[model samples]
Target chain A: MADAAISVQGARKVYSTPGKPKRTAVSNVSIQVESGTIHGLLGPNGAGKTTTLKMLLGLVRPTGGTFEVLGMDSTRPSGRRRVGFLPEQPYFPVNLTARQAMRFYGSLGGVDAARIPERTTALLARVGLADAERTELSKFSRGMLQRLGIAQALLGDPEVVILDEPASGLDPVGQRDVRNLMLELRDRGVTVLLSSHQLSEVEAVCDQVTILNRGSVAAEGDINALLNVDGRTSVRAMNMAELPPQVVSVAEEIAVSGGMWVFSMPTEQTRAVVDAIDEAGGTIAAITPKRESLDDYFAALLAAHTEDVAS
Target chain B: MMKRIWPIATAVMMDSLRRKVVYVVLGFAALLVLAIPSLPDYGLGVESAVFREVALALSYVTGLVVVLSLAANRVPAELEKRTVYNVLAKGVSRWEYLVGTWLGILGVMAGAIVAFTAIEMVVGYFTYGELMWRLWEGALATWFEMGVVSAFAVAVSSVTGPVVVVTAALAALFIGHSRSTLLGGEGAMALRPFYPSLDAFNVVNPVAHGSGVPLVYMLSMVVVFVGFAGACLSVGVLLLSRRDL
Candidate 1:
């Protein structure tokens, strides 16, 4: 059998509200995540990223099509046991200590009672909450609560971890810590499905990405492949005015900053620009190629999708 | 499956135990039941009469408290805190969750009922120089009545807001108390033409008769009320499971 961790085929969800026309949250969406890969689901607010995650977790029944997780039906208990989830906003019983919450979740996952305490302690320490083990959840800060959320999601060491906006309310250091954790999990050969509006975080940790727009998949592929702009090169020179007319005409756009001329070049002619600049005696200060970051790529995809919808 | 349900029930119990409303309501019920002895001297009635009235009133008050608190917090708290999403994502079916919560709330309500009954019994002992067996029977009937009311509140909470739930449950309680009259010969004869099942109203609407208390009678009543509660709770769980949370 193929080792795809998740396989969604033409899945769709429609929410019916009283006195209003039904709203389609996910529209005939199909995607797949292979085993041992970090997959990022990227979309703007209300673009069905969360909806898709919910469907994969079997929290919502799909109106059309089907999805499988870990080679079993998403709704089956055996399949769910191999998955862990972190919701966008997670809350715990106010009186439960961090350690108690872990043990509670662990027990629900059918961990042996004798092993739960030791495992809970180890998990709490791994999540950097060992010091706060005895603290009541009611007293936790937003960042602390998020850490607890992570701990609960990792309680059973699930094969597929799904997180929705895990870094939404974290500080820079907290975000970095979470990013490192995702990388660590990926290194351990766990499949990750994360949805986030923060493109930088996705770029830093995700191996593959799927961008959703207006309830449909707009783009999906390996992150590097999706973000690589093939025909783009950048050059910096001491002065653009001193360059030969032919060399300047070949430049797509040019600007002088910090006593250097920055040039954008078509990918096929970048070597020619370098040769022309060196020959023009315009002493090249720095030569670098510019590739689209995930943020830029997602923004452009969303803009194109919006334009398509509008037209 | 039972293992999964037990943790959910424990979580709900712990969550409800931490709410300040529970503490306040329970404290007030205890004080009210304790003050029954002093009411007779305040010209309310003779000592035994006062104890009976006070025990009945305490039962009604505690039942109302249970219905209001459980109904008010059931769905709203889950949605407000977003914890429902976490558990639901774990493949815990929504029906299982609702049933677990109902069991948890029922445990708390049972505790409250016991506490209030103990206070009333103590007062009865002090005022009459002996425990009233009738009062114990009344307490049993009150428990059944409260169970029915609690189930009704949970059903309302599945589909309506807290305010509406409390209102509808209280109205049901009052209507149930008049069920005896509603199922009487005159009532049945008048309504039988339109509704063939007019006689079945007594099954859903059980009214407690406090005149005499017997263990066998109260036990049978409890069985009947439990059946009603079970049906209502099943409907409640089904409705909640189908809802878009």
Candidate 2:
């Protein structure tokens, strides 16, 4: 569709050797990322997440698939001109200073020589590496290098950006910075495809997510749709020493923390609970659909997918 | 395509400058070039010729060392470190990457050979009070041969690791030069045309003791270099394209 910024269909990768069995890295895995949205790719180790990304970027040869970026075939050089990728644990030539490294990647990204310095300066500052611009990569810490990788990927103002574990080696603050950066990119109307093992980061920023399992897409949808607990509503109230008998009778799961009472119950009891709380002189702080944490949902989903394969 | 290739090549050249081996090879060769006049028992008139011979030999060995160190390890190291991912993921074609690598090795070799030749020229002037411009011809010839050797190293390195690539490249060099000895018999003479002989690049004979080869001959050497290097790089690109990485 016209709204799709990135599309991969039936992607399959099989590695073969002269004397060994052919190993399939991915199979029939398809993903469609809507334009200007943060699309998360999630999986545990060896789930073919990296392989599928590589196949789409032409870093790995695909046995079967069609990959497109911005309505062009992405498995070719020209298609990737408007795209950028930051690989996991990215490495650079250690001898180059950060500025020189940025210029090098900029040149490859088709940035003009006259504009490279200005763009490089801006990107380094954007990634929090303005002070490290003159430092050699050999002297860079892991987090510093990760920041530089991001700076380079942002060169040439690519329309579609792919970041694989962008915060892998970062501290908590750096991880938060990356999360903020992703949100900022989305606000700028850029399409980002983020592959990360850190589900918290994904849950914080991604609008849609695709979770891979054993080389196939195990789950894919909007974050709210996937994580929402159906037929349940969560409620929080303040100034309530004790719930009214009517509210207590309907409340299923209840907890009190920091002077606020929280409970989840069937969505059908919405009007009765609000009326009871109002009559009991309690303030209704919040009422919304209940949702499970991504961590819990991911574990349960993978366990079920694995059990199904085993059976 | 060439736009991307040039940047990768420039990066390779810049990175190679930071390695210690490049300086070590050039330094060792410079020392040998400086000591060429000190060989024992030389006739006064012919001593300069002997010096020229040793100087050209030094240039050949120096070029070979520099080329082997660079071409044998660059691709393998990039692969092992996954640095190639950044370059290729930027939409650089595999052929461009391979050609850019070989071209970078050639650029470094050119610099090394030029520095060595400059040292030889200065030593020649101080020792004999005459310019030995003939040595430039030998340097040119040796630089071209090294280009061919480096192409083979990069080609073989695409599919193999450094140690095996170095061994195979050295073997190819030996066979390249020993075509006559290996195919000397009347029965084998028919196959000489097909064997890739590097003897055409052996311009040291005329360059050191006499005037350098004719302009036409140097032009033919360029043809040979273009043919040999192009074929090797083509095979390298083909092999690397088939790889999963």
Candidate 3:
């Protein structure tokens, strides 16, 4: 984590309204996003994901703890010069056209005045709003505004990008476009911190993930490390009428579909299981570690955390 | 900082142009100025002075309406709509945002005042057969006063909604111009020096009844505007910096 692109350590926020009880929105939540990788932040609503992001971007003042970007204090404006943020449900002045809005953001981001127009044109096209550059924002659909939000975030050529629900309100095709765009940014070595509710989206693009429940980190690690069941191997073999006796003895979870046998067995028994399938005149279609979908894992993790709190 | 402040200000100016309130108020005020000479109270020798007085009054009212319409809702609307996230996330300080918005409102006021004054002068020339150069002085004073008012409204709008911003702004305006009336007693005169009076920009008597305001007084008015606007915007920046957006 020494090369962490963004870090939030011991982050906490407390809200105290005059007539209401003080509420702790986040408590000691910490995250580390490494350089040049996509890190997914996942949580249920009110889990402090947005609050933590807000504190890191200087939009919300943290009651306690440290937030940093590239080793600089991100709570200050100067530290955010190299970082870009897209809030959930981004909005803009309805009177401005896409080009004018981009110019306004570019100037605030300290982009060179002479270069803003060129950047505006390229970024608008990059986000699929090339033809809508002159269209007023009031006429833009929700998806188009989201795209414009993304374009403005990149106006400064920021090294780090923080996106909250980046694919929200996008059509399926538009969501695919956003996914590809994120991959392109990654290929160019830009570090991205993504907070999303789309488990499938996170599962596809994230290198690592941190899940939160009730204002605290429920789990955190590399995606593969978290999702892969230890000491287990999954096998998908075709042209097998039935599992061999030896494979059957070791395999626990087994199923058959489309004339193919799928099962998971102890990692140590993979050689014997493969040999058994070979001996039975079956072809091994795939063999790898047993992995659970992010959806299942996220559900079980939150459930366990909730039960623990209730207990 | 001007690079940052300039765009926000221009955006505000651009936004104001789209709002119908600016055009509607100016249109009504211009028609009034054109009809000033036909008033039934026009005297034998003081027709030009009365016309100037009426024209200046129209200019002030027009500027006030335009300024309030722009300032009272710009920040609250930006915050409610969450458009400010784009600007502040780009390394622009909160103070820069406040000042930029204030300057933008001021820019729109400048345009409105100048346009209305031009209409007044045109009507005066055609009806009275003389140039009304003093109206420009009236326009300047009106613009400066509205600038201070816009700063207050923008500052208050930073943390509240439009209704509260407008109400508090109108109250501030009343207090600003009512210093002598509220503190006219002998004992109150001792506290007058410390009061936040906005009377410095009130040049109606000089511009309408006598020679134009002295050059020295105009210079001092600039100082008052700077002091008042700077103080209000500073308070706004402080409040906004603490509040979570």
Per DockQ, the best of the predicted structures is 3
Once superposed on the true structure, which residue ranges of model 2 sit more than 4 Å away at CA?
none
Write down the lDDT of every candidate, Cα atoms only. 0.75, 0.92, 0.92
Across A1-311, the per-residue lDDT of candidate 2 in tens digits comes to: 43999999999988888899988879779999999999999999999999999988888889998999999998887888888899999999998999999898999888998999999999999889999899999999999999999989899988999999999999999999999999999999899999999999999999999999999999999999999999999999999899999999999889999889999888999999999999999999999998999999999999999999999
Report model 1's chain A TM-score.
0.88
Compared with the true structure, what per-residue lDDT tens digits does model 1 show for residues A1-311? Answer: 33889888898989987999999998978879989989999888888888887777766667787788887888544578778889987787768899888877787776788888887788778767889999998899888888889888987778899998899678898789889889999999899999888889999888888888888999998887887667777777875457667667778677777668886777777678778877877778776665687777877888999999999
Error of 3 at A279 (Å): 0.6
lDDT of candidate 1 at residue B3, scale 0 to 100: 76
DockQ of 3: 0.87
lDDT comparing candidate 3 with the true structure: 0.92
Question: Candidate 1 — which pairs collide?
Answer: none
lDDT over C-alpha atoms for residue B183 of model 3: 97
lDDT of 3 by residue, B157-209 (tens): 99999899889988998999999899999988999988999999999999999
Q: Would candidate 2 be rated incorrect, acceptable, medium or high by CAPRI criteria?
A: high
Rank list by TM-score: 3, 2, 1
Off by over 4 Å in 1: A75-79, A231-290, B40-50, B185-219
